[model samples]
Target: MRARPDSLFNLKKVLMNQPVSRSVSSQQQAAAPQSPQSPHAAGASGSPPRTFGSGHPPRIAIVSASWHADLVGQCRDAAVKGLEAAGPCHITHIHVPGAFETPLHALKLARSGQFDAVLACALVVDGGIYRHDFVAQAVIDGLMRAQMDTGVPVFSAVLTPLAFHEHAVHHQFFHEHLVHKGTELAAACVATLTSLRQIEALSS
Candidate 1:
């Protein structure tokens, strides 16, 4: 099924455009970056990335919130599909109470010593409460901090819109966006993992 136009996210548009990573040449591959860590160090703690020596498929956890069960479910499905299309990924799904709890779930799962990466999904829309912004910001910040603190790669599928009323029209829009977000996140996760592995190979 196709994602709704309102819901579909255009990753090419969403991501900051940059030059693609060039293939490793023997001479350049031999000349690795002087630093052991990349600028986008895995998580919030800033621990050096764990080098697995280039074998094994990375295990990634997809953490989602229960508040927007249906939409998030669709988003999760899209993510799973996207990840599968990319390659074999050990995807473990987890659920939090709401968007506010996504960061903790991501951190906890990342620190579990099982997952290589963490992907979080949530629809943090403004309810009647005046706290959606705070919750959304906190969730994003916490996820970043947690990853740096724990040294695991984390990707967010959580979005906080200025207005997200639960209506047929809004639902249609976000659903499509979720699919795009899923595809985008999947690509990022794979690229990030590959980059990390290349770095490790050079280090050794």
Candidate 2:
């Protein structure tokens, strides 16, 4: 089936622009500038990237919130598309009750040592009276902590829009936006794992 117009537009944009790789490289460059001796560390061009380095296909876990499964599924599909574009990968799809639970689930996956990376996608919008701000922060923080503790890369596409109403127009817009975010997350996952391997090779 053909993707919706918004999803198509987002997929095209991600394919053309590759926001994830650029964002990662930018961060590296910023660090390079700080380390006087490695002024060109980030600028130096390297050989063409391999799809993936591990002899076996990489394993990825996708933890999604079920609260908005329909919309979240778009992100998951787009992410799978991006990952396949890079090369073959094994995916473990999962669903949790809500955005608040994504982190613990992600942590479990990361610690299992069964996945090369874990990606969490959720829509944490203001629910009339609840504090989405705190929930969003806590989930993000927990994801980061999980990665640091496990040495496995973790990425999040969890979005907390300041103003989100339960309407068709808003829903459609966010669904399409999620498609792009998914692609970005996939790109980041691949790039990060590759970079880590490169560093390991260098260190050894």
Which number leads on lDDT? 2
Least lDDT summed over 10 consecutive residues: which range in candidate 1?
11-20
Cα RMSD, model 2 = 9.1
Error of 2 at 154 (Å): 0.6
| Tens digits of per-residue lDDT for model 1, 1-204 | 887563323422332122334457888877986666665566646443333224686798999899988888777888778777766668898888888888888889888899989999888877786878888889899999988999889998888765676778677777777777777777777767877777778999
Model 1 stretches with alpha carbons more than 4 Å out: 1-54
User: Model 2, 63-92: lDDT tens per residue?
Assistant: 999988888889888988888888889999
Give model 2's TM-score versus the native structure.
Answer: 0.75
Per-model TM-score versus the true fold: 0.72, 0.75
